[model samples]
Target: MSATIKDVAKMAGVAVSTVSYALNNSPKISEETRRKVVRAAEALNFRPSGAARNLKKRKSETIGLFLNDLGGPFYSQVIEGVQEIVASHDYNLIVCSTYGGENSSAHRFLREKFVDGAIIMGTAISDSLILQVASESFPIVVLDRELRGDYVHNVLITNEQGGYDAVAHLIKLGRRNIEFLSGPSAAFDNTQRYEGYKRALLEHDLPVPKRIAMHGRFLEAGGYQAVKLLLASKRLPDAIFAANDEMAIGAIRALHEAGLRVPEDIAIVGFDNINLAPLIRPALSTIGHSKFEVGAIATQLVFNARKEEDVIILPTQLIARQSCGFSGGVSEQDHDNLVASILHVGGRTKH
Candidate 1:
């Protein structure tokens, strides 16, 4: 009962191949011919198969959001931003996570032509893996990594500066002997943030104690484990700078369980001021990145590439809250913190 390309071609008085070419907007086809073919298809209530169109144009009008994990509150905001942009052009979105590793089902979809472009998240993805993906000649927007190449577009925050600022704030509070809760060693973000922490301590003429640098997986569990380890140690640092909010929250939980009060006992700071940062008791002082803006920016990049435009970068910020010694008005503080965080993280940190 459905009208096919063949029927549309018959109605247009052209070959099926001609219809395909015209529908794909091939340069070889004249504008008049395209107009006529489109009119015919509309009159006949015909629709071309996505696969058939993909075969001709080598595009699927679909973009992928690839990440290492999607098990957090932040990803939802990013998804909303991406959808807000992609929906404007009727483009489809396919979100997949490489839960296992690089060669995951999500990555496989890219290989099989399921999508035309990609927005890749996760710092754990190696440069080699990205280079391999870019070799496919498809446009890709990378989040969380600072990558540069002909086919790769990068949108990241000023991670090191954020790390530096958090530690500096602690020092300003007259808190010395700060501990660092780092993410996975292989993660690019972790490396940058850790470097920033070290830089802050060095600039302030403070000691970078190996015993104070803790390794975490950027998850709540990792934060919990790291804090527990520190608690069992001989001494506790005056402050803890977690690589992300989850880790900060985890550390907070551990501190609470051990009958230690946050800030008053041990101040805390975090990155990725994710949604739950304020909800978690004393709230979390963190570097804020608009997960929504990141998603929107990445989606826009894919669209730009499809339209033959250059790449663009969205910004980041820092939010201060109870977790870092600030108190009262948690919700209002979160809103303002998100804004402040974005500005600072984007290299425009106001006083």
Candidate 2:
């Protein structure tokens, strides 16, 4: 790894600022100290970054993207889309995870104004913190969360409608006793999806049993455990609607472990048509949206200086596949057709 200024400072037995002064040939530093710093830097093959130096004086011309975790495939397309927009404008992208809430690096980045703007998707960072950091000079675009401020913009999905569609599709497949595999209760998307599930069941005159709703915490492991719990009770629903693809995948694993057949014994549907959805056995039926478009639009809105508050609501689409016993399932060629007719509803911007 390349040596930093701190390494030079430590080698020279001086403060970091002192080493900075010596390297920059400042009058404040003694000749002996300057030579000492230079010799240490040379020994470590250290070189300072001009762009980083310039950041101390003015705008960094970088965009920060904050997320809860960086492990899943869901972030891949979103990051790619953000990078596309960022690279086009000759700007840099810095991705940070807010795993530790305010104590994490994300908070430091926002508080210090190291980046020119931010695109936040993590719920760990509080709304007050975002509001505190955002201004005319530092624009912010948040995903899937609601907040109103002078320079803050929102990009949201039709989560409730997507949830409704998933349940309605199951209903069409003759799945009356449907179970809901929920994500975190605090999550806006989770809450909205749960609402849609209830709405669909009520409209269909089906029993919205509390016992059927299981917490999957939006994780594969969580989904697996949730289904195991239901299996332990010796009462399983005819169908299940997972809030996200990860949980649905996990549930499938659990069902297989129990020697149960998908769709034949219990139908399943999931949200977020991730890349693996089609590859899985009995191709997963899911609620689909343009994750790439969400990231691209959020990046575009980072530079958007609107006089009024801006909230962009993207549309959702239902993908039919064999998992729900809906059809033969989506072929590799039909993956592009995931958007379907629902996309015609179009996205709208609210002020």
Candidate 3:
């Protein structure tokens, strides 16, 4: 075999444990000793065995990224941001999908010590599982979920602020009688958005129609159906605020089919500021968030918790666009700028 930690230690005239401490950059080891150990390791062509190091330290050094589904623009980008930092830190990661219910394999993995820590995607990972993992002293960073206990660190966006901003934007556009197409009633995000919509309406002394604030499944079809349900009553709201971009797109398509022009007829707003929001006709106006930053922060949290640290909360912003009567990013030049934006920096903000 190539040179091992033992060989590096022997060559450096130090204990194997000392070599490990130095390699890990542990504070206990002196910098001179660390340099000498590294120098010897290089001379001997020594490579740290992940298996051996984990066994010695009792840490897998691999973070588990568990989500309800691996597909979707949100998760895809979130994973990208997580991977970017994780690769730099010399930490391996295991991607697990808990889709279609509580995955017995994942549950087993968590209980059996399969990872150093976990980065959970929003509310996809259940509260029951959260409790179960915490019982075993598992370090977890939960995203998008309002649930938290002593051990679980929550990394969340202000869903309520996003919701309020979207609706409030429509209100500023002289559109009143706005209806909220919400996500699943039990979803924390849905509740927060619903509360925001209600708060905006109440602040403006707008009538809160009991039936107007209908529930959508955070999908395109859900938005279509929700709008159709309201349309069947012939009491159409002046504007619609969907909890997500997909639902809003669906609602817009349905409205188009009915010969209702967006903004000119009925203004619409969407949450998430997804990629598709600015691609289609009339280019959807949406409330934006840094999913990449959220993922980055969550990944950082997992790393910190692996070494034992505190939790964090990130912020959100509103993105004005065409469909919601905002002047930003409706034209070709803005689109080019947006694409150019992707090439520049991290947490890449766009128009």
Residue 291, candidate 1: how far off, in angstroms? 2.0
What digit string (tens of lDDT, one per residue) describes model 1 on residues 1-351? 999888988998999888988987889899998998999999988888877766666678787888788887768888898888888988888888877664787768756647877888885456676556563446788877777765677766678888887888788777898999988887878888888889999999999986545777888998998899889985788899998888898999999999999989999999887778878888788877667777777777776664233344444445668877863223445656655665356432211
Report the error of model 2 at residue 274, Å: 0.7
Q: If the candidates were sorted by their lDDT against the true structure, best first, what order would they fall in?
A: 2, 1, 3
Off by over 4 Å in 2: 1-53, 327-335, 338-351
Candidate 2: Cα lDDT at 53: 64
Order of candidates by TM-score, top first? 1, 2, 3
- Backbone collision tally, model 3: 1
Of the two candidates 1 and 3, the one with more favorable TM-score, higher being better, is 1
Q: Which residue pairs in candidate 2 have backbone atoms (N, alpha carbon, C) closer than 3 angstroms, thus clashing?
A: none
TM-score for each model: 0.84, 0.81, 0.78
Query: What's the TM for model 3?
Result: 0.78
State the lDDT of candidate 3 residue by residue for 98-120, as single tens digits.
75455544555676768877887
Runs in model 1 with CA error above 4 Å? Answer: 9-14, 18-43, 135-137, 211-213, 306-316, 327-351
Candidates' lDDT values, in order?
0.78, 0.86, 0.75
**Can you list the residue pairs that collide in candidate 1?**
316-342, 317-341, 317-342, 318-341
Candidate achieving higher lDDT, 1 or 2: 2
Residue 122 accuracy (lDDT) in model 3: 48
Q: What lDDT does candidate 3 reach at residue 318?
A: 70
